[model samples]
Every structure is written in C-alpha cells, then in structure tokens.
Target: MNVNIITIDGPSGSGKGTLAARLAAHYQYHLLDSGAIYRLLGLSLSEHGLLEQLNDDIAKCVAIAEQLPIVFKSTEQGVVVLLNGIDVSAKIRTEEVGEYASKVAAIPELREAVLQRQRDFAQAPGLIADGRDMATIVFPEAQVKIYLTASAESRAARRVKQLQGMGLDVRISDILANIQARDKRDMERTVAPLKPAEDAYFIDSSDIGIDEVFNLMTSHIDAKLANN
Candidate 1:
C-alpha cells in the first residue's frame, strides 16, 4: 500500500495534537498520537511498580512494550484509549504519567519495541502522526514533516489553561518547571531525541492561533500532495 504520511513533531503543549487531529479530520486520514503510546506504557508500568526499575531492567520494559494490551478507537468525540480492555483515555494524560513516559522513552530498547506498533497505523488513505520524534525518528520519510514549537513560557501558559478547564488546580510555575525538565530529557536523550528533521518545515506557535497554524500546515500539505 502506498500511504502518504504527515508528521507533526514538537515538545509538549505545542498544540501539535490539536493540529494533527484537525488535519486527520480534514483529510479523512488515520491519526496516531504516538506519545500516547508511551504514556500508556508508562501508566501500566506505574500500576505494576516497575517504572522505577526501567534503568535497571531494560528487558522487562521491552517485554511490556511488545505485548501492550492497548487499543485506540476513534469516535465522534475523539480517540478513546483502552488498556487491558478498560478505558484509560484520561488516566494517561496526567502530569505524573507524562513524566513516567519521558523516562521510558529515553530507553532505546523500549523505543525499538514500540516502533512497529506505531508504524502499523499507516494505512491506505494516509496518516497524521503527532509526537516528539515523529519527524526526527518515526517518520523521517514522511511527505509532510512539520516541527511545531513554542516558547517554554507560552507552552506552560497553555497547559495551565487546559488543566484549569479540566477543573484541575495547577500553578503556572510548577507546570513551567515540568515542561522545561521534559524538554531537556526529550532533547538530550541518547536515542530518537526530540528535534526537527533537517527537511522539516518549522513553525513557532508561541504567538499564533490554532487556525493560523492549521492553515499553514494544510497549505504545505496540499502542495506536497499535489507534487507527490
């Protein structure tokens, strides 16, 4: 099958997830929130008390990734994630889970285990992959590679608003610190570090709106598809 792919990569809170969803809907394509895969694994490890042993026992983490009991179902509302036959769409989005995911993602062996699962999402129509390494590692040959980013302060502000809307009490300072730490971990990782592919189109969304970002992406994608 010849499947065209668009990869949107960036640090957390860069609005890549939202933009990827919009692009998927617009093009009637499959959407892969790749980061969620790591987050789900992290949540599972936390539940099993193995998160702390990631560095000590790499084999176990790879085992879990190879046999993750997870499913992603698309609904009108959005993608609902199921872990072990139970929905964990909300559970995996917590800040704690995000931190756990960063730790596990840094392990090269575990990433290798999960890589194929992510590739399976590419199908006949197309795919919009969103995550830190989508462009840099996962989909280097993607036709449309986008690197969406924003200032640390802007990302933290957006995250604060999102948490508040969910009725969770969060302080901007704390969120900012977490974002900065995650950025460091993601970029400095030994394997598949978070960085834009050399040929990727970069967009700084610090002072822009979603609509504008979407337009920019679509325009580029449309041109690429036409040429392809």
Candidate 2:
C-alpha cells in the first residue's frame, strides 16, 4: 500500500521539527524526527564511551545503529523517546548531543544503517518526516516535499530564546557560530548533503511566524493530497 508522506527538510533551529510535529497532528500521521534518531545514536555512543572514536571506529557506530534499542511513545506533551527502556527524551536534546549527531550523520555508513529504520515509520495513515535529508533522501517519494529554512542569524536568535526558556544560559554569538558551522558541514558533506529536492516547495521562515509557515506548508500539502 502506498502511504502519503510529507517531508520537511532544513537546517537546525529552522523550526522544521516544530512544524513537522504540528503537521503530523493535523494529519494524524506518524511523526519521524530523523535528527532525533541520530541524536539517540550519538547519545548511545557517548554512553558506550565510543563518541571520541567516531572517526577511528566507524564500524562500531554502524553496528550500534543496526541494533538501536530505542522506542518512541506519543504523549499529549509530545513524543517521549526511550533508549534501552530508559527515558532519554530530554537527554538527547542537548547542544552537545546535537553536535555529536551532526558528526555521526556525516558518516555515510551510519546513515545507511539507520535508513531502513526511518522508512519503517511510514504507516497506513501516513507520515511526516523532519530532517536535513528528508526530502532529498529518506522520503524522496513523499507526496509533499518542503524545504523550510531561515537566515542563520534568525535561527540563532530563535535558538537562544529556546535555550534560555529551558533555563540554560546561552550566548547568541556562540550559538550563531555553531549554527553556521553545522550548516557548512551539512551542506558540504559528500554523502546525502543537505539540499532542497528539485520538486520541493521552499519556505524561508526568517521573516515569518510559525503559524504563517504552517499555513504555507499545509496549503501545499492540501493541494498535493487533493491531486493525489
């Protein structure tokens, strides 16, 4: 059976995750935060004391990806991720874990190992996948492809607000630098680099609000579903 899918791809802090989650609820579809998968893997590696050897021991990383003991539970608040039966929903969202995730994501072998696991999230109703390569790689055949982005400065400012809201002290300059660096790494990586799919609808949220972005995305999705 063919399942309808909507892919939202963009850089970190561009609000793709928030947008994807809202769309998933609106459509009552399964939500796949592909970045979270990598973060979980990164967290796992860190727990195993293998994070430092990512470059020296990629084989170990791939092996862990192939047998990731993770689970996603939906709650009114949001999805709760469990790693090895332990709740790590908050643990994997740290900036450090995000950096680790970015590094691991650049490894082609690790991405390949987790590819099928991501695809399995597609179910009968449909799915909304959020990630850097969702449109270009993971869900290339998705009915609606969206490349949502914002200026680096804008994204950094937003991230600062988020981190501050979480009671974490963060500097905008530091956050800006990290965002820029990650964008470079994600866009220049040789394998599955972050880029808009040829047929994707691009939306720059730099000057727009989340509600506006959501409306823009849903309009595209509605049109696509009507035609489908």
Candidate 3:
C-alpha cells in the first residue's frame, strides 16, 4: 500500500489545527502541527531570553531549533504539546508565543534546521500535517492537500469565543486587528510564506461549521484515495 499523507495548510485561526486532529483520528494516522514545533522553539528561546537574538545571531537560532525537546501527545481533548516532558499545550497557544513563532520561523536557516524533524512525523499508516506551509513547502507530495481559510472577521470571532470560554476578557476588535497583522506578516515572510498548494482543494470556512468542513474534506480525500 502507498503511504497516505494529508497536508492541511492555512493561517492561524483558519481551523486547520482542529481539522487536522479530527482527520488524523478518523484515519488513525499520525499528526504533525508544524507550528507547534516552532512555537516550542519560540517558547524555549523566550525562556532562555534569546528571542531577541534571533535576527542578530542566526547561528544561535539555528542551534536552538536543531535540538527541540518537543513531543505531541494525543488525548481525549486534542493533541497536547509537551516540552521537555512537561505539558506546555496551553502555554504555546498564546498570541505572544504565536508572534514569536512567526518571527523565528522567518529565519530561513532555522526553518531548514527543523525541516527534517517535521518530515520524520510522516510514517506508517498515514500522516496528517497542519501548518502555514504544510502542503506547499513541507509535504509537497501529499496525496491529499487542503487549504483551509476563513474571513479575518470570522476567524477573529471564533478566537474571541475560545478566549472567552477560558474566562479571558478580550475585545473582538483587538482580536481582529491582531489577526490581520499576523496575516500580513505570515504572507509577507520570505521563508515558507502562507499559501495554498496549486493542487490543494481550498475551503473558505467563513460561515461553515466544523462538521460540514470535515465532511467536505473527507469527501475530497476519499475521492483522491480512490483515484490513487
């Protein structure tokens, strides 16, 4: 049997993370959240007070990215991010860490350093990879490539709801602005800019529910698999 790999590439708040996990479970495949890997590196650098040294010392940044003590643990809730044996799932999801992750990821050498580590997750039964460049740059040969997207306003509203559920007070306006700013940075970044693969099936989930999106994706994947 051929190795089945599904790549979901999108910007933050595009629902790629949730979609990837669901697809992984539905197919019993391994999951890779490439952003989390960079987030772990960002968090580690922040803890070491080296985030500011990224552009200044590219060599140091590459060195740090080379030895990331990160692991992904699947659970009833979702995939949990572990750093050095400690659960840091919640810690890496903050806007601060996301910004850091984007900045650090822009360094070409740093991305190259962790490229193989990300590729290593593709194995056995299958793999569902999710991130900004999963389809275009990381898993170009994936059997199924999806580019999930949403309007900035819609994405910000979803993010606001998530933060409110955590009892955090956040303004929708602020969240929307942040989303737009992050979009600009991610798309303009020289290395691994956010974009859909030419062959990717694009889904704009601005007004759709997760289940509907999942159904659409599974339909696409099933058709692709049958043809393959």
Candidate 4:
C-alpha cells in the first residue's frame, strides 16, 4: 500500500508543531518537523561560521544541507533533533538560528537540496509534516493538507511563553516583530513562497487549545483516510 501524507503549514508559533505531533501519534504515522530541518541547517551553518558566506556561495549551503547527519527521535516530551549524534534540540531553537533558517530557506537551490530529504520521511504507515511551505511546496500531493495560522501578536505571545519556559528571556514585542518580518519574507519569496494549497483546509488556531486544533485536523484527516 502507498504511504499517505498530511501536511500542516503555518507561521511560527501557530501550533503547527504541536498539532503535527499529535496527529502523528494518533495515527501512528511518522512526524516531520520541516521547519526544524531548516533550523538544523541554520545551526550547522552558524557553528561552522558559514552564515556570512551563504549569499556569496549558494553551493556551500546546499553542500552542507546534503551532508547534514541529522536524526529525529520521538520522546515523551516531543521530537529531539540530533546533529551528528549530538543532541542540539535546544541549540537550534535560538532566535538567531531561526532568523538564519528563514534567510537561507528562501534560496531555491538550498530548498531543492533538502526537499527530497523531507519527501523521504514518508514511510510505511504515513507522515505528518509541519512547516511554512509544507502544503504549498514540499508535499503538494499529500492526501490531507491543513493551513494553520494566528495573529502575529498572538503567535508572538505563545513563542514568548515557550522561550520563557526554556529559561530564555524573550520579549513579546521582539518576537512579534520577528514573526511579522518572517511572514512577509515567507510570503513574498521568489521560490516556494508560503501559502495554502488550493485544496487545503484552513484553521485559525489563535484562540483554540492544542486538543481543539487536533480534533479539527483529525476530522479532515479521518475523512480523507477513510476514503483512501
């Protein structure tokens, strides 16, 4: 039988990751944190101090993306990103890495290099992918597509709380500004700009809880799977 796919596309802090994880667990499907893939690349580039060279040499970024020794392990808390056998889950969550990921994520060649890696995650049972362009670009043919979103301020507030829980002093205003900026970049980029697929189901998760979002998503997913 062919593996099925469900994509959840959203801006940062829109609960895409949480919803994707829940759906993955519920359906016994694989989870693909597509944003984390870019963030991991960002972390690698930052570590090697090659972020400055990204614009000058696109090939270098593509090279690093292809050679990344990354692994994703599901845990009681959530997914953990391991870089070359070293757990860098927290390392890649920094604001700086996120900004870098957004920048390099716009490079068409860089995205192409990692696109197949994202596709390969669709194994046996199924996959739940979460990212800005998951529905639009990476998994256009997915059986189910969801576009989740919230106001910039709301998302910023959520991000602030998450960072605070991680012991990071984050200001809501700063995060809001970053969200707005990233939204503009992701929407206006020349390659694979962030947008919902034509047939995607939309959910504004600003006021809803995680379980509410999961229920909404599963309703559509269940319908799709039943038909399949």
TM-score of each: 0.98, 0.97, 0.97, 0.96
What is the per-residue lDDT of model 3 for residues 129-171, given as tens digits with 9 covering 90 to 100?
Answer: 9998888888898999999999999999999999999889999
Report the C-alpha lDDT of model 4 over 1-228, residue by residue, as the tens digit: 588999999788788887788888899999999899999988888788888888787878789999999999999998889999999888787888889899889888889999999989989789899998888888888989999999898899889998999888878888988999999998899999888899999999888888888888888889988997
| Ordered list by lDDT, greatest first | 2, 1, 3, 4
RMSD of each: 0.8, 0.9, 1.0, 1.1
The TM-score measured for candidate 1 stands at 0.98
| Ranking 3 against 4 by TM-score, winner | 3
Pitting candidate 2 against candidate 4, the one with the higher lDDT is 2
Output the TM-score of candidate 2.
Answer: 0.97
RMSD of 1: 0.8
The superposed Cα distance between candidate 1 and the true structure at residue 185, in angstroms, equals: 0.6
- Residue lDDT tens for model 1, 1-228: 889999999999999888988899999999999989999999988887889998787788788889999888888888899999999998888899999999989988889999999989999799999999888778778999999999999999999999999999999999999999999999999999899999999999999999999999999999988999
Q: Model 2: how far is 132 from its true place, Å?
A: 0.8
| Span of 10 residues, lowest total lDDT, candidate 1 | 55-64
Error of 2 at 4 (Å): 0.2
| C-alpha RMSD between model 4 and the true structure | 1.1
